[model samples]
Target: VGSRCGAAEFACRVNAAVELLDAGAPAAEAARMLADRFDCSQRQARRYVDRAAGGGRVVVAAEETVVFTVKLPAPLAIRVRERARESGGTLSALVTRALTEFLVRGQARPRLW
Candidate 1:
């Protein structure tokens, strides 16, 4: 088990572990790396990695949500907002769902042009 820590500190550690994983470190290696860096146990490091990878029991919304600013044509923005209203979803939810679908489909279909 990891040492007892506050939420913000734990989130920071998890973010660091995720960054290491994103940078191509293997799971075991990333855990070990984080353990060394944070002076935590290997088990604790693995926990952080699991949480960052979306396998944790407790979901930290603040840590998981990322804010992004996008510029869109006024007409397109209005259309998207209208669609969201029709679907009874917030603008952020609509945009997130669209982006998720687009990314998943993109992964399944390669660009030919």
Candidate 2:
């Protein structure tokens, strides 16, 4: 738990950690990389990695969308799929919308700096 972050930023950080982990980096090493990249504490980095490993989804949204291989526990994956179905949207669309809302809200804030 670092300083409060919007969902898109947190998802981006988590995706980076997942990439490191998928590339065979040890958990501690991945956490260090995440901390360095995001300017966050090691504890915060570790929490992100742990969350992903425990079946959280990692979403990477790009201008030209690319496929990301995320491992989710069966139940959670099923739920997401179901939600997509209920909303009459693709999984990508659902995720994109959610992240977009999060980012938009964050950007809408008045920055002190």
Candidate 3:
């Protein structure tokens, strides 16, 4: 249980969580680590991940919903928006398609080419 704390202590905990998350700690893992470090519960750690994820800097747990803000080149961003509206698909869908293709292509092996 966390005792009554002033503003500075609160800020310190928040910063700790953000740093752990930015270092690629998963939301759940980050929460557990922070809770242990600060003598708090896992829920407190989750709050930290949520806060950082909300700031568009860290990825949230897979079970949680996160909206990512990405800035592409102007032309490409316009094209993606136009296509999404025309096709009735979401911007996420389009990006997912592109990334999936990219990963597949990168992972493909040549048959002794």
Best by lDDT: 2
TM-score per candidate, in order? 0.47, 0.50, 0.45
Predicted model with the maximum TM-score: 2
Runs of candidate 3 exceeding 4 Å displacement = 56-113
Candidates sorted on lDDT, descending: 2, 1, 3
On residues 10-86, what C-alpha lDDT tens digit does candidate 3 reach at each position? 55676787788789988898889888988877887688667666543332223433577877899998998899777
Model 2: per-residue Cα lDDT over 1-113, one tens digit each = 44687668878887887788888999999999998899989999999898667644655445656676789899988998999888754688887787789999989998888
Mark the 10 consecutive residues where model 2 has the least summed lDDT.
55-64
Better of 2 and 3 by lDDT: 2
**Candidate 1 wrong stretches, greater than 4 Å:** 55-113
Ranking by TM-score: 2, 1, 3
Whichever of 2 and 3 has more TM-score, that candidate is 2
Error of 3 at 75 (Å): 41
Kindly state the number of residue pairs that clash in model 1.
0
Candidate 3 residue pairs that clash: none
Q: In model 2, what lDDT does residue 60 have?
A: 43
Model 2 bad stretches (over 4 Å): 60-113
| Ten contiguous residues with the weakest lDDT in model 3 | 56-65
lDDT (C-alpha, whole model) for all candidates = 0.79, 0.81, 0.71
Candidate 2, pairs of clashing residues: none
